[model samples]
Target: MKKKNKSKWLVPVLGLALLAPTVLPTSASATPAKKVTSVEFVGMPAPATAQDMARVYSGASVKVTYDDGTIKSFPLTYKTLFKSTDVINGTPAGVAVDVHGKPIMDRSVPDKPVPFVSDDPDSNSLMKIDGAKPTGLGGNPLSLITHYEYITSDQSGKSAYGIIPASMSLSTIDQNKATGELSVTDVKKVDFSSVGGLWIPCNGSLTPWNTHLSSEEYDADARAYEADPAQTYVSSFTKNYYQDDKKVGNPYAYGYIPEVTVHADHRATVVKHYSMGRFSHELGRVAPDRRTVFFGDDGSNTMMFLYVADKAEDLSAGTLYAAKWIQTSDENGGTANLKWIKLGHATDNEVKAYIDKGIKFSDIFEAADHDTPGFTKIKTYPSGKLEWLKVKPGMEKAAAFLESRRYGAIMGATAEFNKMEGVAVNSKDKKLYVAMSYVEKSMEKDIKGTDASDDIQVKKIKAGVTYEISLEGHQQDKDNNKINSEFVPSLMKGLIVGEDLPKADEKGNTAVVDKVANPDNLSYSESMRTLFIGEDSGMHANNFVWAYNVDTKKLSRILSLPAGAEATGLQSVDHYNGFSYIMSNLQHPGDEMIIPEPLKTEVEGYINQNFDNKRSGLVGYISGLPSLEIKKWKNTNKPDVTLQVAAKANGAKVTWNNKEHTVTVEKGVNKMVLKVGERFVEINGETFELPSEIRVKKGRTTLPADLLDSFFR
Candidate 1:
């Protein structure tokens, strides 16, 4: 006789699990969490000593609130797959390679970290591919991680201000069957020399079709560069990428969206989408519909952009539009009704033809410093530069995607968004979240349509705000054409706001540490009902990764990085082998902060101690989290969301593919498999009659209330 499973159903949507078995070892006391109520993170003390300032630590304790209001705490430690200093083959991870595949050296540092080990590693685009990659533990499910070096800084710590081409690497990461941890078997640099290398590759997102959508931030001012090539900072790109300074670089070739496709053999291929308008692209978050995309442009005087592909799961061709914010209220960070203004439409090949044919910015628009008769007076958001220009007639497609910021202004879209960094969406809630790093300059209270780009005028919050955009279906573009997408941003309001202190606190902090400060990267977990925020702050003494539960409105500071580092590579995956991962990375551990003298010096020493002379960044995840992948299911005389939650809590791995789901749960050495939408299941290799037929609804696998007891028992 066995005990019965009193729980109902379990739904493990396509969530992603993470890291290698050795990312970090769990203690002997560590056990798989059975039931999760609410996850609460433990915080660390503010840094005062050299040891405190440079320490990278995590309490990783989870206090989950249960259904009946019972609370239990457990340990969830932090683990690292690899640091930027880790080497594979003969080169360091994320080093920019040449056309001939040699490491690019930075002439700035004495013991150059450029070729030795990139100092500013950013984005961690982890995704699984088809087939298995051969590993020492045998063939494991193949996974590819498209990670990159944002921009290499010197020993003095000048980031994007310095000369260096951003680089990306493809690492072969797969789970170890024996230990149930991820293993990093190989690392190869994805060469972008064929497309002007990479330009400040900062942040990225994964496409709906399981591809990597990376970005080129800080879009170079091509007009100024073309006018005076010798003065532009991108000269290093030509010298490093092509190994020739005289190779004459084209500024237009570096800013478009680059999509990477991972292979079964652990290799990656990249293709730049010219149709998706580019201007300091932070994250190109695709909607669940797969075609609609919202971009976060990072800089002062930026614009909100949207693109709808001609077909689902395809970004090669699309129609570009910019947002016009019609303010609804001036509360919190302000609420507004968004109006889409049609910029233009084009395909990837159409825009690339102009780049290959040597089309200049002057060819796209004839400009003047003053208002002229035929010129349209428009101000570009990212640069805050006013220009009088009109499309040169034939280069409409080129101007639409290449100089998207300027063209957006010409179409009467709102350009007042400042420091818009990361974008995330929740399909279930029909919501989109965008991070504004600083709520000043463009977003400060101002008169509408003055310079045109400064339209968004809300009370300044400086510390920052995360906006929630409402999504609606059956929308039309500015030109009154059907947008053909279900996810269109209709209204936006601030969901989370950071508090700004009047003066420096006792810890010399300008912003409240208990709340978010300059929130940069955001990843939303639907099942957990949590919004994960990472800081890229100049106001806080130390940066933190926070988990803010949307339901309970509880803010928990989960992990703290070195004093001056900003958090990066934050992504939330729902289904991966019936497990979930909250991916995050640390960058520029020893950056120069604007704090007072003695404290700053103390913090610098701490960074040196923890980071060592390598001054390298790390890539890892917060581990041992409870399996909260279950969703509600309706059947067996009730509607329940805890079906999959119950199954996972009972140590089961549920997977969905082609309307078929298999639940694999183990008790001792006996492996049991339950196939939903079927009458019978298997125990290892032997057939067994189910007490009742398991079912599925709306593509979700559900457990029948009566059948669950027999199976678990």
Candidate 2:
């Protein structure tokens, strides 16, 4: 990585007020939110008392007793957010409530904890509302607050763990956008025991039956720790279908299970589904028909995969498939076709074969004192209705079979396949999008001859290009946003404009049309499928959110993201207004800095560097800096993310600092026109000075770090 050095300054934490807060709303709102169907208490931090943390967490349900005498149950899940001495106890319990007041029950051990159990006085988890916040309304009703963690395994035996948590907020976020702040508390820790296991951030899809289809993303070497039934750290979460009637503890009604470790001895909350292929998955989404599920493997050499649950509802027993893009080059403008390849049979025998080949069973057998031997027998899988694929007649059956055979080779998949990350469906559009990273393509170019005299020589020309896929109307919602549109092929034609496409100068006087879509006028097939490609590495290494147009058999809009940003997950929800949430790890261009290792030293240095004024505004113009510009910056573009900011001044002087980037607009007098060679910026009329040199890059420009220097000074 080329280290870019620039000035970095820290702003007062108070500046965080500039960002909007994220509040999850309840189903009663204009947009009905996804109801909280269930809740489970995972490993809780050691509580101060010996009482099982699960008991307090699972049983608690808060009720708001409004002044009107109307009572509403608040969804709450008590869990250890962080094991910190900050609280008197090692296990500090924080309540995570689904603001939407979705019901919760234990799926694994069902037939016990029933709804309305909140009314029971014996429950430790019920929240009794004594009074509302003082707005002069003593008995007025208020909303409940909860928290949850986005966690994953280290996969590397190194023990380091990453945990991302959203800031605590009342569920009514839309209403609180003005005063509420959407912040993410992040912590990366390294410890012991849980080391080396693959971390699973299972972004499960909503099944037709309203259950989640959660899949596992395991590390390849996870089996090294196991002796027999070689486990590679894959876990599954299935709906156990059991409803707990007793007000005892957990009311999941359905529970998630870690089946890969063969730790079956440890009673699992749920069973594993071997039918879904094992890999490092970020998220998975099922097709409308609910028969086909598309998933992406995270990390290098990731490949797009699909699992055709023989029985859509019964994903436990089904054949898995991988998508293979048919590479082609012809006058019809080189085409890419997705071919489905079967991974394994739905039978338990096939699953056992994977185990025999070093997949561990002990990972699922929690009771095993030590690792055991590999077991290979279809007998291990429970007999159940297995889902199968329904292939169309006159289709490329041979090609599909051939592709399946090739993908079935796990070893080959590791060696030959590239990483395919981020699979999403635009529910409204009925299109699916998959993202690939660091993909290279050749761009034809013509060079002049070396002869100085006369003849212009043509040089052999080929340039490598990396791009994302944009499939029109493939991943659409039930209502149909793009797929159902009357403007079909023609609208799709102009979707993806090449990078070199001509654009007039800043003046917009000239027409620059370099290249057009490789294959224009693409029409969707009956099965409008799509994929999104997110590149993690390479030169011009950008994380692109590309969509594939299955109908036209070509890529459509190629959303080029800032360098180093990865679009890891996607969710198109009608619940959160009309917005498609794109979860990304894009480094924010502002709010960054470099401090010395020693806490005292870095602080002293930072203070001295700005002469006691640590703000960026104090520093004078640093020259030779490259300006960062974002042509398409939008708050809705990135949902559920913490923004970082970076910048540069004149003369290409650069600073790669990390500052809290705010999306909230600042209060200002008015807007004005830009003069020739003039830069635009906001300043506190009372305390700030104009930066000596500020240049705005066309489209989107990186806010200068000196803005802080100029103000703080």
Candidate 3:
């Protein structure tokens, strides 16, 4: 990996460059230093004894109090479940062959985690395992269940579907399940070569029928032109995938949800659901009734959508609808009334027929002006303009089904939902939880407007918030054709929003880390009544997985990842071998080293070279550097006391004296002075001792950064 020299400063510390002065007799000094009784040094505050340091450091148990005054404690442990490299080696031989008939090389995995555990209703009956104490297909009293891993790809050359069967086994199953441990085992990958090349496969739902419903996120508009060379209405964002004469097949063949069913024989079959409508699908959440499904779009300024199937078990035929937001109030956290606007209805065959004809998917909706009989104008909401497509005569009604987002916008659906992510349903309260990684002010518009002009200016700081929409008292239309219920949506919870938290430096930037921000994938466990939230956030240095209690509105940190890593596919699983599991993916960790020994020299050099004069900034701020510590100067003779920095801001201040070649640390009226190149310090003119002499390297001063915490206390 190539290294980039991004930052100029090395690290934060306090140091001074001093020149040697002519020697003077002890009694001949001009001004005599006054001696005082005692001296106190100002230093950083220490963490209270009550703080749970162990919980944050190791996989120890911690209790979190919710906003509603409810309490729940659990031991936090994050196991690597599986890595991308593991899946490559785990694939059965002769299963996947490349374009040249050679075995496909190992590929990287993306962020989709779908489980097929023994306790899952669909997998239980299919695998002939008792749901109560289910075992794996291998029958070793299965501790870990089967799960599917979806790999998103920008390259068309790699395989997108890989499965890890029985990745982890539970060591024990008991009432204290959270305390139970899991032992990982070698698992093989089940390849889905029949699905063809999948592009940007994202999050999806575990279907009511016990199958995996994975989504295809990005679609190339250029694919539409390839299907119909005469097409004129293609979106400008489409990429020309066939430019290099790559025979990678049709682009229109991708972008829909591929339902995969893994049989007891360990073979899998994938079927793309054209009827579910194609867009940048984030994921789908199936309703308990099985007919209605909620889907989130993972693009900027996108729409929230749903599909109603003709049958409870099948998704091959359905009517798609987009949410229309009706602002009830102007407050940021106020409730908004939601109504669903019908886009269109079509079966998989009918949609395929339109694609077979000369009808490009983009031709279904009016992207720009100048076309006759363009999209029909629909009722407008404050969010944006709404219109429905005017399907050309003799054209199959599948245009709306293929370009679902465009059709939904034309039908008066609100497209202001910024990055609509994971969707989960609360079976007990009949509420749907929608995770919007970014909630913009524009989504709160109350008046109708045209799609041509922009009304709401995007804000600089965007925080992740979860909305709770009540689905109570839903009633069908008189014709029994559509549901005519108003969805009242209120801000259920907000992450990383407050005055104390740092804001993003620029609009849409993700540099600042608040308490919690950018909540992504969500999974709700009915039995535990807890919602597991995984983060795909750039705002935080280390992304974390959180557990929130729906009833009590309490949230707690369950797991965290290293730098540049994201917590993906967080889900609450059923008890197995006496343990309940929360499965998640730690994606793409950064190069930051976690161990101390190898980094000791590098860290010490950084502190000596880069300790800036500015004191109030993040650099040299004790709280900012969580891993800072003090150590003995290399090859130092004297040894006694050392300074340590604390976490609080009101710590001690150290001053460097250039003329006298000395260092002084002060806390209010008290002071301690240490001469340059000496191991002893004078406390209020009284001799004091130190563990080592003040060291200097490369013309810069050095000291143990953390040892200052002791004097302040």
Candidate 4:
């Protein structure tokens, strides 16, 4: 069944099912019943005894038999997970790694740089070496990592480098193949001259062609300045650093999506696609066809956009359309019909020509109202306020492409989405998922009367939600409506909802549950058929990354960030050396106490009052399997007998004591002992039965091949 609303909480069931066998009856005759040897489970629980089954973890698995004599089980294994570190060794000149292992200061930061003030280091993309597989950078398949840095600092002030709000950088990680350890070697600033600058580069996606598609958020006013240079600066942060651009009249160059292509040799090239309509872009998801693109506008009362390119993988020339929401009875649950309203179409060069000609973009909207021949208005249902401007003149057409959001508003696109963050496509199911950080009744405010004001009245708010849009049979809509040729918008339904945490107790203690608040970035793993969701919320004490199983409808908390931190860039990798891995980022953690001048005193006072100072912003990987080491018995008599050991966070070291006749498996300070030729192991003098007896081969003691299964679980 579907969930009721975005704020509905999903309480996970915390018990594990007991292992049971299925008995199958013979035919109708009085024959003996046959026993089925299999069992099935939703998620594989940790290896536990009968007493521990009832309190198994949420993601833990269990085995059960159905009445029909069918059995099933999920893959259950521990993995080596990485957490944010406070130290990044070997800092190069001009670059200083923070306690979180993040490169906070790159080459662009002048010597004796101004006090660094930044927040929200979002988006994590890994560019691997040529012919390298996805076994992670530490494995032989992939040995190097190309890391991208996003500084979501929209503060206004002077620094040693110059006045700047937002910036981007690049770094490299050298991995030791033998130890599976990572180290940051070099960090450098990325030149964005081709795109003016990077503004609020948030959660991004790795394209199928192996390129990075970084999105620009909160730059809607670029079009306003391009239309009329007299308009007051929309943002003080950009105004202080980009004053020179305002003087040169190039505000239109900053809002479009930028693409970064990292070569095999580690060099990179950045380009901005002007053809992709400019707005407060959050995420850009390219379809498997490589021509259809879906993007979200991250703000209250914003529009959902679609772009269709003329050629495959070419976004430089395309036709943009905006979605109109048709609400049904289940609107609150994110179920609604959608229709695409054609905004305009143009090439990057064609739109740039109009900007170069000093033509005000606002004039094109004015020209749409005139009784010009061949200019027609496209109608929107209910409120015909949103009518498309059929621009006959070429310049007017150019305006539609340049100022896309403004054109979409005039064309009646629904502005009800609140913080539309990430967009991801599930290629296997042909479904699209969009993350709405949170929804409020104020998002339904009508913008017809106050077109100039960007703020929408806030009345009631709900928690964050993820909407699933079905793309099946969408192509048929082109034939259903001749005017909507080649453009068909599909319906949206809520897939998952986030909830808030309860207040702490008198002692300031709170329960640690698998709850998420603001869902920001989304990613789909084709191999595992799961959706990875990241959070960017201030409402929760700590943000978390959740993994939702599509087929089983089970949501599990995979990772959690530190205090005052948000999770970003939840991506799944399937192309690396036949192994699967997840890449995620923790942005703007609340651990560091460094602050700028004026705010330093205030921040310090607040910290002293609160007595809390913990910050960590890092990029790391999550592997699918635990670290394992296998050694086989040398004697031929010991067929199928071998030694196997696995560790979760690090490799387990095996130590043998010939005189004591004991085999010790050690990871960190935790150790377990198995006596030679024994059928049970000892942990702190507590005995546990093993699956098989230990053995010896070539003067070396060995355990059964699967003896360590319980150790890792």
* CA-lDDT, candidates in order: 0.71, 0.26, 0.45, 0.52
* All candidates: CA RMSD (Å): 10.4, 22.5, 19.8, 12.7
Please write out the lDDT profile of model 1 over residues 1-713, one tens digit for every residue: 64433442232322223211211111221122234556665554455566756766666566655454544344555677777778876657767667777876656667655563565677777776767456665636646454564554555655544265667877776664322356577777886756667777778888878888888888778888878875666665667678886778777887767888887777678899989986888879899988999888998888899999999988988899989999988777889999888888889998888889988878888888896898887766544677788988877777788889888888888878889999888878899999998988778765555574456779889899988999999988777887778899999999889899999975567999888899999888877777889999988878888888777777878887787788888877665644466678888786756667777787777677666553678887776554332212223453334346666766766554544456665543334456765544443222323334667666555544443443444
lDDT of 3 by residue, 1-713 (tens): 53432321111111010111111112211122222211111121211121221111123243433232323222333443323333323432112233222233333334532222111000111111133232232222222223222322223223232221111111111111111223333333334344443344567667767776767665544333555633421221112212223333444555677676655444445677888887777777788878788887876657777788888879888877766666554343334666666776778777766655645545554333333355554322211233444655543355567666655665556666667788888877787887777665444443455442232233323556666777644544223354633332222323323111354332222444334467778887775466767666766545566657666666655564543345555555443322334556543343222223333234323322321110000000001100011112222332323332332354667666789677777665344556667654443222323455676555455543323323343
Cα misplacement distance, residue 405 of candidate 4 (Å): 1.6
**Candidate 2 local distance difference test against the native:** 0.26
Regions more than 4 Å wrong, model 1: 1-50, 65-70, 108-116, 138-146, 155-162, 447-450, 628-713
Task: State TM-scores per candidate.
Answer: 0.82, 0.35, 0.58, 0.66
User: In model 4, how many backbone clashes occur?
Assistant: 19
Off by over 4 Å in 3: 1-74, 87-193, 222-248, 356-359, 362-390, 394-396, 441-461, 476-481, 484-514, 591-713
Q: TM-score for candidate 1, please give it.
A: 0.82
Kindly report which residue stretches of model 4 are placed more than 4 angstroms away from their true locations once superposed.
1-117, 129-165, 175-182, 222-249, 367-394, 442-461, 473-489, 500-514, 591-616, 624-713
Show the lowest summed lDDT stretch of 10 residues, model 2. Answer: 117-126
Q: Rank the candidates by lDDT, best first.
A: 1, 4, 3, 2
Q: Write the per-residue lDDT of candidate 4 for residues 550-596, one digit (tens) a residue.
A: 77777766564544456765776654422335666665555332223
Q: Model 2, 344-421: lDDT tens per residue?
A: 445433453444444232322222223233311110001111111222233222212222321232212221222334
Q: Which lDDT value does model 2 have at 387?
A: 15
